[model samples]
Target: MSVYSMKTGLSSILKAYSPTEREKAKNIAINKVRFEMPKLKGILDAVEAVNEHNNFQPLNEFVAYLREAELSDNDFLRLMSDAHKLINDLSPKFTNLVEALISLPWTKRQPPALQAYAEFYIDIMVAHNKYVQFGIPKLISLWIPADGDAALWPNGSPIEALKTELEAVHRLLDRILTAIPMSFEIVLEAIESKFPYFKKATHVIAGYIHSVLWLIEYKPIFTEFVVQLVLQKLVLLDVNAPRSEIEETDYDDEELEENENAEIFEMDDCPKVGNIFAFLISLTTTDDDVQPMKHPIAHTIDICMEKMFNFLNTKNPNLLNASAEQKLQLNKFWKILLSAFDNVILPSHNTHHVQFLLFYYCSFKNTIAEAFLTSLWDKIKNPNISAVIRQAAVGYIASFLARAKFVHLPVLKYYLKELCNWAHQYIQSCDQYRQNGSLKANIVFFSLCQAVFYVIAFRSRDLTVDRKSLLFLQSLQLSAIVTCNFNPLRVCLPPVATAFAGVTRAYQLAYCHAILERNARRKLATVYANDVATPEETLDTFFPFDPYLLKLSEKRITLHYLQYQASEAEEASVVAGHRSPRRQRKRGDSEMLDDVDDFIVADKRQRNIELARSQEREAQFTYGLSPGFHM
Candidate 1:
């Protein structure tokens, strides 16, 4: 077949067949073009013919086809491996095709095509730097003092060598930066356009951004610029502004404003936009070397912090009142913000920045605590919200406490006390609670208790100093956990032989306390051994309401034994499976608790009667009006 005939045949088949069927059609077309039209090699003349024909309309459909099709291994390898036979190194046809692909409206293009161009761009990069390699020695050589080192070069003056090295680094970096021009832009657009469906693509773009920042030096002119870009991206600020308001005067234009207005931020954008935080962390990372290479900029950190604070300040109404789906999005943003706080923002070396953060945290500490706790309480109280959403809210509240663990201990303690008091009041108000009936209020109270326990545990882990206050706080924390995990069983004269359900929980809580106590006590013994005044004084106010807990030194050990026995029994039962229906019930054990209420009432009556009889015995004093002989 002639070249014209082959081209027409290929076009017809591509147009006629489905994307999945096009591979077979492509095979037939390739054979015809390869064998029959020997004058035109596979790639060179094909690209030239397409350009000469001015037929670019089919490229879009071709891109769509590539996206929809998954070629077999053999065909894919053949396509890749045989490409060298088709191209002439001297020809500019391949270059022109690449340029055309690059210059196309990438944001409008399909991902597969953009990805294909990305691979091509990488190939071009490899071709450009086929002999060059950037290493630590090269980077260190660039930084060497120009006038101090003569032997560093041996070929020329230090200045000349430095210049050459710097140029080489810049050249290599520039090539890398420009390799996939506007491809990331397209990816970002696609990410936004496709929303949650293209999350993997979002990660891919984020990974690409990370690689770029990692491979290149942020020194010289790019540090501040890149930092600002990354910070803005995190906050979803696409446009860059000047450092000063005066300098920023010319930033806003009609087109820019229009584009800004056109931009829409959806819930799906959270993870993609939030990726900037991870990138920021990477930027601030350092090695163990005496002179670390890079550090996060103070100003850049300020920008990100302000953005986050502003976001939190404005507040998401949905955080408090939202549907499950809306809550999911809000929670996702919260997770990202919390992660950034723990990983980057809280650990920042900027004193003023950290102070500004602490200032806000301290000022609004009560308000924040109130908001989050109230939201959580409301969720648990609400019957309309699904169990999953309510449970998620509980989890979110726990995470919020963790994130805000840096709040002053006294402030946190005050909030916790308030929460406990409120819960206590709620329980007291319920008639069912006084009657020894199961109370729904216990759920909210227990959830709050659990939150307190988690916060205290976190604080214990984070506090390692040997200060007197640390010891007090440590004891207070352990007491709080013990109290929170305490089960409410009325201790009567009969001493009901019941299994303490909270034994296992208490054991766990006590273990954490033991860890804190061990560390804190050691520190006190080592540092404050000579300080008699400190050792003699003890605060009773910080202790839990239950004195038995403090007296039991081997409580955790005993609980561990009981827990092991219970687990062993449970495992044996599981192995035994079902038992005979005629099995005997244990003594004092009610198979149906509700049915045993009559017995409980009778027991209570008996106790009351006994108390009255004792009073009557003591009432012999009532006959004192009579002569002493009458008694």
Candidate 2:
């Protein structure tokens, strides 16, 4: 008979006999056989027979019967209960039965059937401990909705039905954990192995991430592991998704407004007309001179980042009014986040957006901010840490202090003093080694000095607000640090050095014009001397916590972010004379005027050069060179 005829005939046969009648007939046939056999032995023989024949008729029939039977059917419940008892006898060799059980649709079943299936699943794993390895993976596979179902919910909101199904999955997992406490490692392994690839559909990845976060609530022991895993994935996406790609994509305001409320799960529903990946790919084909492009993952990064930020914000909605218990919980959460930062985010290079999660979290309280600053300072001061990490740490500290609107003046001054004191001590200690040291050897000191200057340039208005603050700034001996023999002005990026010089000169805190003039002349002379100028050192700008540019998360960051603006002094000078005095030549002191003019011209020229170089390195650090650094 054809396959259709066979299926029709089987369906008719199943319909002809109720489960009760079938069980009674089975009993009668066994009695007539006149053979004494244990029930477990009979089950084993049936399984062996199925395997020998390479047929799954019995398994298929059982699944079909369960599907067709009513939830309250006693025969269905008893059959499942008996199968639960025979779980111990089920072996890997019983492939058909194992496959059938694994393939059962628990998600759509009624509560009683769902419970029965869950119990049988747990019993099988509990009976055969090794099955946990396979079973946990199967459960994890249900974490993401099927693609067709995801398409149905195009807005990315979790479907209520699917949510209920996932809740059942988690509860089943909870019971499995209770029965097999030692299977935690197996579950973790399964989760990691099944983690959605970063390039997968945003909803799929977000769904898995949401499930992982949900798992943390019930299994608190997995907090650190889960946090770190999520962060690692976020970092992977952040690093690959260059901010420039997003900026360069051709999108209109209406589309951006539409996408503003879009969740990670809703990325598929996002319009493809202005997609960064599509724009980039189009460029590749249309322009013969264009370089090959890496497909942009910015949308994916934005979704993941928004999810994480939401997760954290929900955990500590009102830190101020939180009770002691809530405070303790927040504290524990902070520790886990900090630890994850150190292990995953800290060491990472070229990550544009993931680090802002720490920034947003620290904004909750002054104590958290202070603690974060202290952590970076400790790392910056540690001589044993790698220079690269120390450099990145100092960059983070500077950016955090400059951009964080919540950091009060005293706190800023306190850290500024700390940084200046450290720079002073470092300059003094490195003075003896300065003669023999290469720029690479003392890069950390140069980085620290750059950080101090960058922060001072950013907060120049606050620093020189009054006599007391000016005196405090003067007392930090920034002049001495800048004028040190090490010559950090020349070693740091030109734009930062120029801004620091301009701010100090305007405030009368330091006289760096001469040093900058000298450095600029030397750079020019080196270029003239070589037929092909080879730079002695190439320093990529390191600003870890720059403007958070991910479109979806920008609102959260912008509220707390202190944007760069001209100081009152500079603004007034511009209003009065159309240019600052430092930019114009002085009346008396022709030599000094000449020096200032040369410094101005050279600063402008050096900026042009640096801009070109920055463009070259744009692929490596998209946000590294911010326009805010320019005076």
Candidate 3:
């Protein structure tokens, strides 16, 4: 048959076919193209000449071109959109034509055509993906870092070698990130009713979700593809996430913040993001049973937490309103959530960002979550960190303690004791940090100290630490000496000053009491010789109010500055403010949070400075902030 006959035949079939019939016709046409693609391979050089000279306008259109009796792939997508996807117009028609040739079976006469077409298609996709949406393009750059080789990737693609062909491959992955998942929406509909096997491949749906999240700016754009991605990555418990997720997920973006020290505990059977993070937490401890997951899993979890915030942001999922069990599960994972407090979401790094994350978080429980808190005193005293991170961490801690005044997490007692112990050691180690003044080290120290403070102050009394309740006050005084007062951003303290400053002064009294108790234990052990370490017995505050926190609160100071008057308060009738503990929220969590957060601007330097003054003056005053605070 003539090439014109084939083209006319396909177009006529498409124009007349019904939806069901079209799909069938598309299959037949696709197979025909497969057969026909090779027959035209003999005329490749002629087409290349036309392409190189840029003189084929009248000769061939994008969908189909006939040069000297040779046929090319049809770029007419409307005619064959159902059958072939490579029918691109905006970028280059040559790409689609080459791709068609590449997919041809490698008969003796057409061996090189298939390979060349494959390489060309890859090159086109990479270029198209770049600078278009910039989502997938940006992502591929992260995954395919340049090695010395410039021709191909280690995984068999053309990326590792930094070749121009590989450059196009990268662009293609980027464009695919935006384009393919969109195609998945139609695919999902097909899967649901049109095809039986579609539901079985939810993993692919989930994979798309993970990408669409970054690409999508608004909620209305959520497609079946994006939803599936979330379902697979965050909610899917069956199969481990694909190996690509490891390349896609690890980042330090969620590095625990400076003042949050909850030692982010998690159950062993938790989800991948949490379970692996929990294991990483265990590596910081002395537990023999806490073996790490394989290194690859750890990398994936880290990536998910850091880079994938664009995917699964910790702020809140779009879907909510859990059953009692899910709520309980949420409560169960408060420790895991606590680890997020110190998390510095690069986007959410500012006070605005913190408010955004907290707006989603605060709706689940009154006051900030417990695991998210800090020791009240330590956050108050720290001068090393900017007041921005300092205030957010403190407010979260206060809210946490208010909630803690009720029945606690049960395991919190042990968490607090460990925090106290870690704080005690870490403050001492701050002096030894190689780059003590480096921002990373300071943030790490801030996070470490804050985590310790939460450990000591908010710990449950159930666990015994040396037969004495771990001294929360003593822990803060020590952690703060190095943290709040020792501004490495300014100058390092002298050795004697560092020693005398942190815990040495106030802790001497606590230490003296502890020493007396230890001596009594030693005397008894010497006499009896039965080996059992003393269990630390701690006491909890029965009263809802804490005078120590009341004195040190910046919230009170902010209120004093605002005179408790909102610049533009939400209307009492239109939007019942969250300030009314009794009022039911009228808006969505994010909206109500938006309204609440709308008033609290972080850049109000005058207000924060006044709050800082209040904290410095009355260390014993009650702040009435949120759930938890530094000791």
Candidate with the greatest lDDT versus the true structure: 2
lDDT of each: 0.34, 0.69, 0.33
lDDT of 1 by residue, 383-405 (tens): 68754444444434443443442
Which candidate should be chosen as best, given TM-score against the real structure? 2
TM-score of each: 0.27, 0.75, 0.26
Give the higher-lDDT candidate: 2 or 3: 2
Cα miss at 418, model 1 (Å)? 2.8
Off by over 4 Å in 2: 1-45, 48-82, 152-157, 250-296, 317-323, 433-435, 536-538, 575-624, 627-631
TM-score of 2: 0.75
Model 1 alpha-carbon drift over 4 Å, by segment: 1-189, 192-206, 209-405, 432-442, 453-631
